[model samples]
Target: MQRNGPIALAFHSLVVVFMLAPMVVVCLVAFTPENTLAMPWNGLSLRWFKAVFHHADFMSSFGNSVRLALLSATISTVFAVPAALAITRYDFRGREALNALFLSPLIIPHLVLGVAFLRLFSLMGMGGSFGWLVATHAIVVTPYTLRLILASLTSMDRNAENAARTLGAAEWTVFRRITMPLMLPGVSGGWLLAFINSFDELTMSIFVTSPSTVTLPVRMYMYASESIDPMMAAVSTLMIALATITMIILDRLFGLDRLLVGKG
Candidate 1:
């Protein structure tokens, strides 16, 4: 493997700092004692963090966001597994089309999808329902799960599966015992990716969310529209922390570098 030259290393460091600077600022602002999102803090404080829980809308929305992300990610993974299997294991009509359909959301603008979903659900009289939001989120996140699992499947050796079958192991037994265990890392990584995307989602969520189904990101947008405060920073900081922790857990369990580099 070739090592990065000094120029490449410097460029990478600068890019990383550029990307992280906003998050660092937000984390710092979250500790500001002042009410506004201004610099030169009057001393570090946790008041805004405390205020985050006190705000009724934010609290409720945070819970809703958590539930939505979990459900969407799990469901997406369940659906993705089978689709990925079909794509990688069998030759069938529309296989390419099916893969394309699964990945369509990535190419299409999210705002357009949001409008389409809104209009479709309205016609079905299911507009603004929690289930409606979950379904949409699953659709958007499925491709991530499918791609991850497909990568895992494509890289998997067929010898184990063949050996199991030759030993009279049923198809389900081979899958449940052999394939699934090997695919676990991909499945887990996919779930984390979907969860992060769903949790941070705002564009499509903005269209489908009802007053009753408002998520944390949408709520944050609404609040920021009316107010400028460290509370928003606190909320952002918390979200950043949650995502960071998730990534750390993923790295510990699955070797994040291996997973991202398609070695899973």
Candidate 2:
């Protein structure tokens, strides 16, 4: 097997450091004892972390973001699974158009979608409604779910399905027993990706969110605009920790290599 050359190894190491530097800095600043955002040179403190918990706006925004991400990711998955099945398993009129429509969000800019959704919601008298917000997020994240589900479906072996059908198994029974299990890894990975994206969404969320429905990213943006403090860094560190924990759990449950790269 060919191994990475010294130059290639050095380049990869630099890339990793470049990507991780900001997160490392934020985590370090989060421990600062000073009121201002800075590295904890003199001493480490947990006051900012405690402040994040005590701050009502941040807590509320965190709750909203969690609920929003959960709902949107699940909703997108529910739709994406069936849509993926139909797209892959059958021939239908306008199949290409249907596939394109579902994936349109990937190409259209979020800023444009946000504005369009805002106008549509206003006309429908649904502006600032949490349900509508969840729907919008589901729409934005659907393409992620769809693509993964499509990959799962396309890569699936058909022999088991054919054998089950040959033995007089019903289509639903075959799907439940064989197909769904095969696609589970992709479904789960897609859901996690969608959830993360929804949780971190900012650009479109800013336009659509009302004060009552503000998300964590939106709240953080507002707070940072008004003040510069270690508390912001603390909040960011916590968010990074959350994302890390989530990925760890996903890796444990599904094997990230298998779920992401179709490796056994």
Candidate 3:
């Protein structure tokens, strides 16, 4: 066991570095003084970061992505909380099937779902509608929120709920005061996951969104197709920074191990 421990630790370190290297590179390149992208020292400067803010298209798309992510994550959580609660707290016909249905989107390929949405929206004459984009993102991200909430629900102690009900506490009151507080960590984790997914979504957004509603990822894709520059790196770095901050906050508040694996 002791011999294996060092090997396992080394393997884990390598895996983490492998996963994070690209992001670190992007952040490094974002500080390049030149407009072009290159590694090694360029006498680090914030020119690209400044350019990203001044770039009208990038700014607009960034706003759109933030709006869509917030809306989609909030709506997905709202729908998922009830579904998760139902699946865990009640026994009903088709419960297993219903769970599968909510999770089906995760199994489906994003490209295939994008194509399907394009066809469906075309038939409905709602192609390129912002509402359709929001709805599709919500559907795509709901499974994540549902899974987290379900994990919390399953791990939570039921004795408190039972005692509250036994003492004549109403169902709504029990849920509001007891259940919701206990579920907050899962809810927040799910929301953050959903938000990240929605914000980073490109394939589905490309099919459903109009030029006016283009998301940051899609916009970045289009820009990259036209040119390669440190501006893209700057945008990516900003996103990475935002995600890192969010994770840090969550880790401090509820502990990610508890939220993800139900253990602290």
Q: Write the per-residue lDDT of candidate 2 for residues 1-264, one digit (tens) a residue.
A: 246687798899999999999999999999999988788999899989999999999999999999999999999999999999999999999999999999999999999999999999889988999999999999999998888788778889999999999999999999999999998987887898789889988889988999899999999999999998999999999999988987886676556776566434
Task: Return whichever of 2 and 3 wins on lDDT.
Answer: 2
Clashing pairs in model 1, backbone N/Cα/C closer than 3 A: none
Query: Residues 1-264, candidate 3, lDDT per residue (tens digit)?
Result: 999999999999999999989999999999888757886384878888889999999999999999999999999999999999999999999999999999999999999999999999999999988888999999999998888889888889989999999999999999999999998888898898889889989987888889899999999999999999888999999988888887787676566787667443
Query: What value of lDDT does candidate 2 attain over all alpha carbons?
Result: 0.91
Model 2 stretches astray by more than 4 angstroms:
1-4, 252-264
Error of 2 at 66 (Å): 0.7
What does the lDDT read for residue 248 in candidate 1? Answer: 85
Q: Please give the RMSD to the true structure for each candidate, in Å.
A: 2.1, 2.2, 1.7
Task: Give Cα distance to truth, residue 126, candidate 2, Å.
Answer: 1.3
Residue 61 in model 3: lDDT = 95
Q: All candidates' lDDT scores?
A: 0.90, 0.91, 0.90
Off by over 4 Å in 1: 1-4, 258-264
